[model samples]
Target: MKLHGYFRSSASYRVRIALNLKGLSAEHLSHHLRKGEQRAADYLAINPQGFVPTVQGDGANLTQSLAIIEWLDETHPEPPLLPKEPLRRARVRAFAQVIACDTHPIQNLKILARLRELGLPEEKVTEWAAWANREGLAACEK
Candidate 1:
C-alpha cells in the first residue's frame, strides 16, 4: 500500500490518523505541494486531480481524504470510526464533510495559491485566507 501526499496537508494528516486508528500500514510517498510536485506528470498519472493523500491499495487508487477514510472504515471495519445507527452515521458524515469540504477547502493551499496567481498582494492573500477560515468556522458553528 502506498500513501502519496504532501506531508503538511491537513487532509493527508486526517488520512494518516485514520490509518493509525485502523491499524493499517502504507508506504508514505511525499509530493512536495509547495514545489508543485503534485502537478508533475507521474503524480498526475496517479491522480489526475492532483490532490494530495491518494491511497493506492487493494487494487484501487483512492483520493479525497474523507472518501479514503470512509473506504478504510468500510474495508476494515473492526475499529469503526462511524456509528452503526443510520441517523448517527449520517450525522457523523455530515459533520465531517462540513469540516473537510466546507471549512478546510476555502483556506487550503490550493485556494491560497490561486489567490496569489490572481495578483493579490501578500497581505491581501493572507487576509483572504484568514477571512475564509473565520467565515467557515462561523458557518460550522451554526
Candidate 2:
C-alpha cells in the first residue's frame, strides 16, 4: 500500500489520522504541492486530477481523501472513525461534507491561485479564506 500526499494538506492529514487509527502503515510518498510537483506527468498518471493524497493499494488507486478515509474505516473497522448508527452516521457525513465539499473546495490552492490571478492582494486572499472558514463553521452550528 502506498499513499501520495503533502504534509500540510488537510485532506492528507485526515488520511494520516485514519491510518493511525487503523494501525496500518503504508509507504508514504510526499508530492510537493507548492512546487507544483503534483502536476507533473508521473503523478498525473497516478491521479488524473493532479492532486495530492492519492492512495494505491490492493491493486487499486484511490483519490479524494474523504473517500480514501471512508474506505479505510469501512474495511478496517477496529476503531471506527465514524459513528455506528445509520442516522448518526448520516449527520457525521454531512459534517464531513461541510469540510470536504464546501469549505475545502473554496479554500484550496487552485481557488487561491485563481484569486491571485485576479490581482487580489494577500490580505484579500486571507480574508477570503477566513470568510469561507467562518461560513463553514457557522453552517455547523445550524
lDDT top scorer? 2
Q: How much lDDT does each candidate structure score?
A: 0.89, 0.92
lDDT tens digits, residues 6-94, model 2? 99898889899899989999999998889999999999999999888999998789999999998998888989988889999999999
For model 1, state the Cα shift of residue 16 in Å.
Answer: 0.4
lDDT of each residue in 58-127, candidate 1, tens digit only = 8999899998998998899979999989999998888788778777888878888888998989999899
TM-score of each: 0.92, 0.92
Error of 1 at 113 (Å): 1.8
- Root-mean-square deviation of every model: 1.5, 1.4
Residue ranges of candidate 1 with Cα displaced over 4 Å? 138-142
Worst 10 residues of 2 by lDDT: 73-82
Per-residue lDDT for 63 in model 1? 91
Clashes of each: 0, 0
Model 1 lDDT at residue 38: 88
